[model samples]
Target: MTFSIVARSADGRLHGVAVASKFLAAGALVPAAEAEVGAVATQAHVNLAYRSQGLALLRTGVAPADVVAGLTAADPGRDERQLGVVGSTGDGATWTGSFCHPWAGGQAGDGWAAQGNILVGPQVIDAMRDAWLDGSELPFPQRLLTALRAGDRAGGDRRGRQSAGLLVVRRRGGYAGTGDELVDLRVDDHPDPVTELGRLLDTHTMLFGKPDPATLYDLTGPLADEVAALLAAAGHPVGVAGLDGALASWAGVENLEERIVAGRLDPIVLEHLRRTAPPGRTGD
Candidate 1:
């Protein structure tokens, strides 16, 4: 009924999970991670305890394989559960219980695990594993979701798609650097949940992601003039001396405040303002 991948970033500072299932709101139950600790995906009979318990074990420096062993060995329903785990400093591990529906199993390697139950075929897990290996260049959250998408394309839950989720954690990576959650996106229900999940991730990145220093432009000269005009056209006009304040107000309204800088502008934010400015106006 589900497929998932759990992984740690190459530098070992990030950990995450991406999952999709015929079950509703799989995100709420199947995936868990802790920055600098590890990630876990528990499905099939879905032992919810495996999520927190697995992380606790990883926090103690337990190897992922041992975490799986310890968790399942102590459960009477272990034969009906499926699990995958990855620790901060070692290879990942996976387990498919004996009673899980057919076309179920998993694969694991350094820093990653892919697993599923009631899937279309082994190809689902295979595709997920291959994508995880091939996506080393992607951002951690994107890489995990890329693997989930591959499994979906290969034939995900045998029943069909209903929900999807992506979660990534890094130290001080949350909103305003206040928590460990870097990305926690969910498409609780969608006709094409994986695709919808991808779209939400893009929006999340735009609204919450850090601006690239390389792409920031000083708000002086023509660039500043263009922005000022754009703001005015959008009905937040300001005098020449108050450009910064006006830009901040406009960005707040547009929910682009995270990308705002004191005297510099992110190109992405500038483009968004241009695109959203009233049509027939010079800024537009």
Candidate 2:
């Protein structure tokens, strides 16, 4: 009752998984990844151990196919479990257990794996694989989610959708470079979980994404005046000369500190300020 994609970025520094299932809180169980190691998706009978154990195996430089072999080889219930894995290098691997419900299988290539069990049909995995291949130029997280959305549109889980998740890991890529979780989002339960996941991903990008140097706007002229007005309306009054500290304070309160630059601003942060500028007070 699930579909998923596990992949490693072209440069081998990013690893991630995107999954959706008819099961409740599948996000809490089905997907796992470690920066510079690999990613895994375990569903159908759902062997939670496969997540950590698979990452450990990948950490040891095991090929993804061997990882799948070693994992299922040790489980007595292997025939009821489905698994997909992608390592930091070489081809990915996928397995569909014999006892899994009908219309179940998977596909794998150089850097990705797409799999599903009790899906509407093979088209789900087919669409996912095609999307992953065609999205080689997309940002890693967006590529994974794009593949997932393609599968959903192609007829996902036969039972329906309940939960969906996106997880991407990169070395020191977490918030403020303090962790490895670049994007970890879950829609535990929603009427349209995939779409909700996309919305949350956008919010994550805006709040936690790094500033593009080319898009940074120096605090000057009209932009500076507008920011000062917006800050004042938000109750954090500031003069042009004091924009830096005041903006930082406002950003911290709004949980946007990660997007703040010392003497410049990210357009995303500016858009957010205008969006939340108390309606008519925004000055259009």
Best-fitting candidate, scored by TM-score: 1
Give one clash count per candidate, in the order shown.
0, 0
Candidate 2 residue-pair clash tally: 0
What lDDT does each candidate get?
Answer: 0.93, 0.93
- Error (Å) of candidate 1 at residue 224 is 0.8
Tens digits of per-residue lDDT, candidate 2, 1-284, equal: 89999999999999999999998988899999999999999999999999999999999999999999999999999999999999999999999999999899999999999999999999999999999999989989999999999999998998888999999999999988999999999999998999999999988987888889999999889998899889888878785649998899899998899989998999988988988877667444
Model 1: worst 10 consecutive residues (lDDT sum): 275-284
- Where is model 1 more than 4 Å wrong at Cα? 239-241, 282-284
Clashing pairs in 2: none
Residue 46 error, candidate 2, Å: 0.8
Off by over 4 Å in 2: 239-241, 279-284
Q: Please, what is the TM-score per model?
A: 0.97, 0.96
